[model samples]
Target: MPFIEDFNNNHPTFIKNLLKKSPGLTQREVLLCMYLKFNYSNREICELMNISNSTVDSYRHRARKKMKLKRTDSIFSYLNQL
Candidate 1:
């Protein structure tokens, strides 16, 4: 399955680390992380998640912050741990 393929290729350590750092993120924030890391845009995320554009944006920001990722940092740095 595509999900399995994606999961296998990407390490979960980054997400795990982020989750450990920020335990207050809602389910929506967690889902946003999965979608974003998998290369989904906010619009696509909204459609797939059945949520609003604003909600996706908000969740993305919250997820990144919850993960302790600096705003000035590139998203690629987060993937390096994999």
Candidate 2:
């Protein structure tokens, strides 16, 4: 997978768009997305966020819904906007 080496910090801006469109994602969820979009592997995300793997999964699910990111295949799309 080569770790999807390209990185971007345009997360908050993209999330801002999501917030505008959905008007439902909470500030906590947004922060979680920003974390995932930036750094933290799944395990680390869970540990740092004091949540379980499934909770992280739930965050991802909700994030995709809020952002209208229909497919995980295109995840880097958010990063590219940086």
Candidate 3:
């Protein structure tokens, strides 16, 4: 996985605990969560992941849904709390 190595290297504990808490998350979703946890902007995420803005938005929405977050909930705050 392209981002997995960087994510694992930079945030092994967060990724591990996130998987424990939300094991249903896919690897890509975990990567999105990791970026959000770091307060990365959508533009930054898009640039780093070499994806489109819409793709980043889609990932954020999917990740939030998978995490059972409310529409108004903050993904960053939730991940930080985890």
Candidate 4:
């Protein structure tokens, strides 16, 4: 629980490093992945990113594919475990 707070606070740096390590991911994909890491819903992501819901979905889907994640896998869980 405490680490969640730390992770949330340091998320930008963490996300930056994560994106750096993920060569296949785009900036938008990294942004979406970071939001997803915090368990943000599509509506919340769209609102924060000033994007459409379908755009959010597309980014997430593409991110998942680029990361080679299974469709059933939780992106939040995967990122957190890293």
Q: Which candidate comes out best when scored by lDDT?
A: 3
lDDT values of the candidates?
Answer: 0.68, 0.63, 0.83, 0.77
Q: Which stretches of candidate 4 lie over 4 Å from their true place?
A: 1-9
Each prediction's TM-score versus the true structure? 0.66, 0.64, 0.82, 0.75
lDDT tens readout by residue for model 2, 7-27: 124233565565676678786
TM-score of 3: 0.82
Provide the clash count, candidate 3.
0
What are the per-model numbers of colliding residue pairs? 0, 0, 0, 0
Task: Rank the models by TM-score, top first.
Answer: 3, 4, 1, 2
- Lowest summed lDDT across 10 adjacent residues in model 4 is found at 12-21
lDDT at 21, model 1: 65
User: Model 1, stretches more than 4 Å misplaced?
Assistant: 1-15, 79-82
Tell me how candidate 4 scores on lDDT. 0.77
For TM-score, the strongest prediction is 3
Could you tell me the lDDT of residue 75 within candidate 1?
A: 55
Candidate 3, lDDT over the whole model:
0.83
lDDT of 1 by residue, 7-33 (tens): 646654655665676788786776666
lDDT of 4 by residue, 50-82 (tens): 999998988888888887788798778778865
If candidate 1 were superposed on the true structure by all CA atoms, what would the RMSD be?
Answer: 3.2
